[model samples]
Target chain A: MSTNGFGNISIMTRSMAWLIVCFLVLPITIVFAVSVTDKHYLSLPEQGISFQYYEKLFTSGPWMTSILQSFVIACASTVAAVLLGTLCAIGCWRLGNRASDFVRMLMLVPIMVPTIVYALGIYQFWIDLRLLDSYTGLIIAHIVTGLPYVVITVSTALAGFDPRLEQASLSLGASIGQTLRLVIIPNIKPGVISGAIFAFIHSWDELVLALFIAGRAVFTLPRRMWDGINESLDPTMAAVAAVLIAITVSLLCTDAYTRSRRA
Target chain B: MAGLEISNVTKKYANFRAVDDVSISIKRGEFLTLLGPSGSGKTTLLMMIAGFVQADRGDLTLNGQTITHLPPEARNLGMVFQGYALFPHLSVFDNVAFPLKVRKQSREEIATKVRAALDLVQLTALADRLPRQLSGGQQQRVALARALVFQPHLLLLDEPLSALDKKLRAELQDELKRLHRKVGLGFIYVTHDQEEALSMSDRIAVMRSGKIVEHGTPTDLYERPNTAFVADFIGKSNFVSGSVVEHRDGGFVFSGGGVRFVQRTKGPAPAIGAGVSIALRPEKIGVLRSGETAENELAGTLTEWNYLGSEFRLVVDAGPFGSFSVSVPTWQSDLAPEIGAAMKLGWSAAAGMVVAQD
Candidate 1:
């Protein structure tokens, strides 16, 4: 095939890129294929394709409850994370000093620290606070883990934003709050939206933090999926994995679309 | 008193003084330009006037009311930033209506005022276009409309036309002057372009080393500069440095580089033997005919020359006395310039002014 305008990308390099995509996406494709398996256990369709597992996903009490719980936790945590993270990013961007640099670095500590280690720390803290096994503890843990994603995306967006727009807004009689609402926020809207999406996905797909803090009362979808894998070998598990993959892929696609639109 | 007053403003960053004890009172409806080279604190002083940069020591008052401590939003001044700073997300109409909206104006009022402001800049047709969609000159006009829509007490423009092409810049310069007159608002324009300042401003404040070196009408500063820095910065000038040799008549004679020239001054002449520097404009010196006489004359060989459309710029290498640059108008000069040709350059006593060395 011709390299076209891609600047002499060799056939081997193009094949390697395809190879990497397959390597990354093949497992999800397998899960998707298994989701339509005819058999009750985990296996590719043999007799015929079936939608029974998918039907079970929507109809089953435990799966539906877990999905609802996960949705609520993800949404609550994403809202909290976006609020705090966007404020922190704007503050650091405007301050533009060594101290703000240190603060921004500190906000990234949750992402830098190993997730299992942080989960264990949160586990201990939640037990002392008597919040373990509750919605509040799980949401708090998810928010903490989701914050770095929000901060990183928002900060990247703020980096491209011209500071003079803020000055122009103020000089034109915009109050500080008015400037943020009318000028700064609108200009950095893509970043904020990207951050919110990432934060939501971060909380939604999170397993380790949910495993540590969540109990029967606050069972999230990821924790339930983990339990399903350990406790049972069923096509329903494949169906759930396929659904999560689809949701994540679509969210990421939306992010890419919005970002490209901005460019 | 119905204008902006900036007094004793100083801005220090670390050890560098960005603006040093600058004071200027702008009369109502005056076009005052802060003209300087880069890093000359002209922009800093303008920022202080716009309430962006806080003065370490100063009093900024608008019409007898102190506004030194006021925030930028409270200052009620419109600023057209260096690069226009138009909101990318807003349409040209919305951008012009921003200040009015910020002040919580009614929808009809904002529409009427925005339409009028856009009409003022001849951008009513582009009201729906985003800033990124418009041409450079169009964006500049939008910025002007936005700054004026709210009828700000004063308008501050920081190198507003620096981003445009030469032809467009000239067109906008005339537009800005017309807008100033029509609106009758105080305009504090900052620029490093001397021609832009000269053609547009009623008064020009020449700044250097964080201080206003001199401030006067453009003609006054160009014709009678107070310092060597102002003379060289405002326009092209040849410097003749020497000590006062004799006080003859009302003017005095100064000798430098084996050449003596008479300089006319209304002020007291520097004491005899006192070091004095004279700034002689290139256009003031002319090529003298064989029998023609001038108050000061020098004979030199034409070392180099350039034909500049309407004028011939010749570099004459006068021996002992340094080279003198003389501009001869194409219409007035009958002599053809040639390299290595000896020529007599002459200028009257009133042509040179004694300026203090910066």
Candidate 2:
């Protein structure tokens, strides 16, 4: 009788976990199915599967341009964010006082505030600075939004790092910059890489800020996808979403592999 | 004049003084140890000397040059921190070669020097292994090698062996002493372990409450500690407090626990009727047999006893003086110690020393 009770509980938990996973993954699978639909509109294929939408997504000039623009912005903003955020985390970790703690908390405000609110706030500033509709403006805006991820990850890495290594380097005749480059940086490489990946994905998928500040001259991938959904229910948008899911999944897998190897 | 000099150094954290008004001059090739219990400012003093912690009021000179305001890199001191803070990402070879690389030494010189440093620690076979891959003792040797490779003016170690097991720590203690002899550079080591300090240091400075209570050679500090704290901290001691009653030729008579006894002092004698304390070692007192006598004797009942393989330890309860712990060698004692048996503990006049109460 006791064995039956334990077995029943285990079965219930296992079924519940599987149900939750299926509920979470069902929408992504639908998007993948719609991507290969044979129809011209947004419905699933009735007769046979088709590669027409995928081919169209590749061939279309606007789609290619938007993808390129988004890639450039993500790369630029990720570099800026990693550099600024890693330094900020290191400064906070080293200072280890109330003021630095307050500043570290302030870095997370961008992530905490609603994206629409941040977009409206930055839209006003971009207009005042006359930086609207430019690559520089979009890159800077994405960098501000991407910084918190980098700060959090790098700060966690620094928490586990032995502060004595820095002292040892300095005592061995290495200057402050030399210690950071040779000892500190190499030790925290995993955190920096994880931060860069998050920052890149953030800038790649961001649409609200691009919708607010970006104009005709600088259309990003998300902005183009948003326009496609509004102008027409095109299945090519489903193909774009599938491609985005693939890229994001692959990047996340690489990050997981790196972290596991480190462990 | 050609060694490190720290004068009137102090460090305060808010309301607390971590290291206060301390000064020490280390000779060129001396192995000095800052010995104390936890929170005794030994490590803080070492950090101040290493240029990691700034002194609130002091001057630090190295080889006749004032380096009080110099950064740690410019000060040119090597430090082996607690837990052997090796870079986890770098191999042993790269870790030891770091200082040479920082100075931009020729690649050939760096390789040869790194090889020699590894060879000194006898870790040449594992040069390519990361710090995580090495055992605790091996990692300690790597930290030592890295600190010595730069050939700094002085090497400071901050409780570097506290992380190891007892047997491993004992092994490294001998290794460190041999390395100190080989290098011939001044070493300033910090630790709370008294045995480690006594066994390895040329001179030991005992610290308490951010102050150096006494500093001397190992034997001097052990045999003639000036304070009750040092006597108790360095080794096991039984403190006996009394008031001086008379002055003798080379000693004084003190009435302690309703018993008068003579205590000799090489230093100035305490005034008559002044309260005083004496630190007596347990091993110095012996079990007096029939017809045997000593300068001081206390009769009591044996309340507890233990055989420690090499010696027999007995606690005797004297009526007025409370309990006196006496240790007798197993070979010297023919009678077995039984609890509640009458015993007479005896010691010579010089076995106890006058010590100041903390």
DockQ of each: 0.95, 0.90
Recovered native contacts, candidate 2: 0.98
Q: Over the stretch B1-358, how does candidate 2's per-residue lDDT look in tens digits? A: 8999989999999989999899989999999999998999999999989888999998999999999889999988889999888999899999999999999999999999999999999999999999999999999999999999988999999999999999999999999999999999999999999999999999999998898999999999889989999998998788888999999988999998888888998977899999999999899998899899999988999999999999998888988777887788898789677889998888888999899987
- CA lDDT, every prediction? 0.92, 0.93
Show model 2 residue runs off by greater than 4 Å: A1-9
lDDT of 2 by residue, A1-263 (tens): 56656555677798899899999999898999999999889988889999899999999999999999999999999999999999999999989999999999999999999999999999999999999999999999999999999999999989889898999999999999999999998988889889999999999999999999996999999999999999999999999999999999999998898788778
Q: Please write out the lDDT profile of model 1 over residues A24-85, one tens digit for every residue.
A: 98887999899999997999999989999999999999999999999999999999999999
Name every residue pair that clashes in candidate 2. none
Cα lDDT of model 1 by residue, B1-358, tens digit: 8999889999999999999999999988999999999999999999998888999998999999999999999998988998999999999999999999989999999999999998999988989998999999999889999998898899999999999899999999999999999999999999999999999999999999899999999999999898999999988888878899999888999888778889888989999999998888999999999899998988999999999989999999988767888898999888788899999999999999789986
Quote each prediction's TM-score. 0.98, 0.97
Candidate 2 — what's its lDDT? 0.93
Q: Best TM-score goes to which candidate? A: 1
